[model samples]
Target: MTMPEQITPTGDMTVQTENLCAIFGGCAKCPGHAKAIDCGLVHLNPDALVFCIHGCHQLRVREKA
Candidate 1:
């Protein structure tokens, strides 16, 4: 028997493949700063929140700490 081919992450979440966008808040080094930046690869979680894969240090969609 042959096993099914595994799907690679491709640096993106399967759930939020469509309409993906990063929602950044605050500076990467500082939390006090609030800002938003557009990300190339963004994935949404169960709650439908966007997250950045690059780890820009900005506020991600969900708990990406």
Candidate 2:
């Protein structure tokens, strides 16, 4: 069996207003890199530099990778 993908999340309605967000280096440039939405979104945390919006979704596994 293969390992599972980690869960993640995101933010920003108008786009890259969150200059601190690293989601796609910035929400503005972020494509729908969503493997499952729950694990696709990225954000920043007060305790952690990087954070996920959700924590119950698994990312899809690419056959090529």
Candidate 3:
């Protein structure tokens, strides 16, 4: 699937926020970062902590060092 544009007429910024997660150096380093869909979402009353289906499928909590 093609990467969704950050700005859309829909006015949803979820995708843009998701990209930030990738830039955190975690998903950004992942093989699917470039093609990630429904990734990290940040907004009040969010539908879910992880909106990305692919990300959820492969979700793993990082253990504190």
Query: Best lDDT goes to which candidate?
Result: 3
lDDT of 2 by residue, 7-65 (tens): 23345321222222244444454433333332333333222232323222236778995
Clash pairs detected, candidate 2: 8-39, 9-41, 9-42, 9-53, 10-41
**Candidate 1 per-residue lDDT over residues 1-65, each given as its tens digit:** 12112222345443222221222333353332221222223223323323334334345577668
List the candidate numbers ranked by TM-score, top first: 2, 3, 1
Global Cα RMSD, each model: 13.7, 14.5, 10.4
State which candidate, 1 or 3, has the greater lDDT: 3
Best by the TM-score measure? 2
**With candidate 1 superimposed using the best TM-score fit, by how many Å does residue 49's alpha carbon deviate from the native?**
1.8
Compared with the true structure, all predictions reach lDDT values of 0.30, 0.33, 0.37
Q: TM-score, each model?
A: 0.17, 0.20, 0.20
Q: In candidate 3, what residue range of length 10 has the lowest lDDT sum? A: 33-42
Off by over 4 Å in 1: 1-47, 57-65
Q: Local error of candidate 1 at 41, Å? A: 13
Predicted candidate 3 versus true structure: per-residue lDDT over 1-65, tens digit per residue: 23344323224433322433343345444444322233332243234222223463365889999
> What would the TM-score be for candidate 2 when compared with the true structure?
0.20
